[model samples]
Structures are given as C-alpha cells and as structure tokens.
Target: MKHNWTTTKLIAVGAFGVLRVLIWLPFVAINISTSSPLLLIFSFFFFSLISVFSLLTIRQFGTVTIQTFVEWVLELPLPSIAFMPLLFAAAIIRALVVDLLFFFLRTKEAAASIVCGGANSLVLSALTYVVYLVMGIPGTQTIPSAIFTPIGLLLASTVVFDLGSTGGYTGYLVYKKMANTAVMRRIQGAQ
Candidate 1:
C-alpha cells in the first residue's frame, strides 16, 4: 500500500500515539501498585476500552504503518528488549488481521474490531509466552505458580482485547460524529 505521510497525517499519528501512552500510563501504574488479578482484570476491561479507542482513532486518521510507528514510540522507554519482539509482532499481526478480515468480511463493524483486537492481543500474548520460555526467563521457576499458567494468561489477554476492540468500535462512531460536526461548522463559517 502506498503511504501518503503528509505533515498533517504524521502529526496526527504522533499525537495519537502520545495520547495512547498517556491514556495507558495511569492504568499501568494501577496494575503495578496491586497484584490483584481481579483488579487487573477489571482494569484490563477499561484498558481494552481505551486501547481500542486509540486504535480506532489511529485507523481513522492514518494507516497501519502509522499505527506501527506509534507502537514503537510507545515502547521506546522500555528497560530491555523483552517486549519489543512481541510489540513488533503485534503490530504486524494487527494490521494483517484487520486487512484480511476487511477483505473477506467486507465490513467495518464491531465484529471486525473485536476480532482484530482480540487476535492481536492473543498473538502478542502467545508470542510473549513463547519468547519468555525460549529466553528461559521464568521457565521452570514460575511454571509451577498458579498465575503463570499459559492458558489462563492467554484467555485473560484475549478477553481484554475483545473488550477493548468493542470499545474502540463504539468510540469510533462517537468521534466520527464529532469530527463531522466540526468540519461542517468550519465549512459553513467560510461561506
């Protein structure tokens, strides 16, 4: 696909990227402050909403390349490369999943958003688990723990993704309305 990265589009993408991180920071802090699975789950529900909203905004204003760039910028402050591979993989998978679904299903409804979001999260979570295993970071150590079960983690991630995507779909409709209204007002004013 040919990308038309005009200054306006780039700025919009970058601003949206920063907005994504800003929206997520508070939730991340909350997650860090508590190890409660229930809390995390609840927070994930909200995070999914915010994440999806960000995804929708990005998609509305830019392309997958811009989305991926935003993801990279979000991860730039990480202490190690532990999450880089997973993030990059997520970006590619998200784009492909959305594109393929868009092609076959030929719809941009809530279903598409939910499927794309959950698929992206699941792929990333699964990849992270595999990478963690291969790197031997918590291989034998945490495998015995209840929280470390692969299936549970994957399911949680998937649920979060689904919720977030649904939220994004809802948010897109709202944002588009507001945007259209603003544009109409500006046009009317010029006449």
Candidate 2:
C-alpha cells in the first residue's frame, strides 16, 4: 500500500496529543493532592488503558470526538461505568480528529500526528487558561485540576511514548495552530 506518509504521521502525532490529554491529565490531577498510592496507581492505569477506546473510535469512524454525542450522554443519569467512560471517549475522538485532519489536509500521517499533538497542547493549555479566567479564580476542584491537567497530559504523553516521540518535539505548537485549521472544516457537521 502506498501509504500517505505525511498524513499518517500527522494522524499519529495529533492522535498522540489528544491521547495525552485524555489519558494523562486526570491521573496527574488526582495524584497531586491525594496520598493514596493505590488510588493514584489505579487512576494512572485506568486512564492509560482508556487509550484503546480512543483508537477504537477512530478505527470505526472518521469523525472527531463526538462532543455533541457526549453532551447527550451527560443528559443520561447513568452510573459511573456508563457515564464516566463516555466522558473519556473524547480521547478516541481526538485520535479520529487527527486522522480526519490528515485525510483532508492531504499530508503525511506523521505531520498529522505532529499537528495533532501540537493542537492538543495548545488547546489543552488555552482551555485551561480560559476556564480559569471564566470562573474568575478556581475553587478546589478547578484549582488543582488546572495546574495538574496539562502537566498530567504531558506526563502521560511522554510516558506512553517512552522512546521520546511526538510529545517531546511538537507539543507546544498545537494550540497556536488551532486557528490555522479553522478554515478547513466546520468542526461539527450535522447533529
């Protein structure tokens, strides 16, 4: 198969970035304040394992994380297993998003992966800033979460990519490019 080297790379990096956020931040956030090693360890493993779904979702659909579908999921009064997993589903969508972007950009998967990772960092950091600003100061839940979230994401990304892959080089460039990709897709299509 004549692989789209550029697009594939981009997809990999981008997915890897989103993967960073979904898989890492929460565990870091939890570990920072709490002393429960068991809890921390479990959180780390669980989030890391969640990475599979992110890839699975992309393998199935060519869409980004269905934030809208997720919004619907929130409406349901499901228990932890049902609703919580749905929330983590964003990681998978994030991966799919990078793939979709690579497809449309007509680039190599490597570049897509790079773009995706960069996008994730920028978005993650900016999002962290925005939420903090919007809330004016950040309470207990928000305070620890804000500081640890990006850190957690970065940590998770680095760990998953032990060989020092995408997260090492292109992690910072992502958010700046977020505006760059706005022209290509509508972000959300229909319902």
> Whole-model lDDT, candidate 1?
0.49
TM-score of each: 0.58, 0.35
TM-score of model 2 relative to the true fold? 0.35
Q: Candidate 1 regions off by >4 Å?
A: 1-5, 27-62, 78-87, 102-106, 136-158, 183-191
**Each candidate: what lDDT?**
0.49, 0.38
Question: Residue-wise lDDT of candidate 1 within 70-92, one digit each (tens)?
Answer: 75667678543424665466556
The 10-residue segment of model 2 with minimum total lDDT is: 182-191
Tens-digit per-residue lDDT, 25-85, candidate 2: 4654554447322233333233222222232223323333443244324435532222344
Position 166, candidate 1: lDDT = 62
Q: Give each model's clash number.
A: 1, 29
Residue 40 miss distance in model 1 (angstroms): 6.4
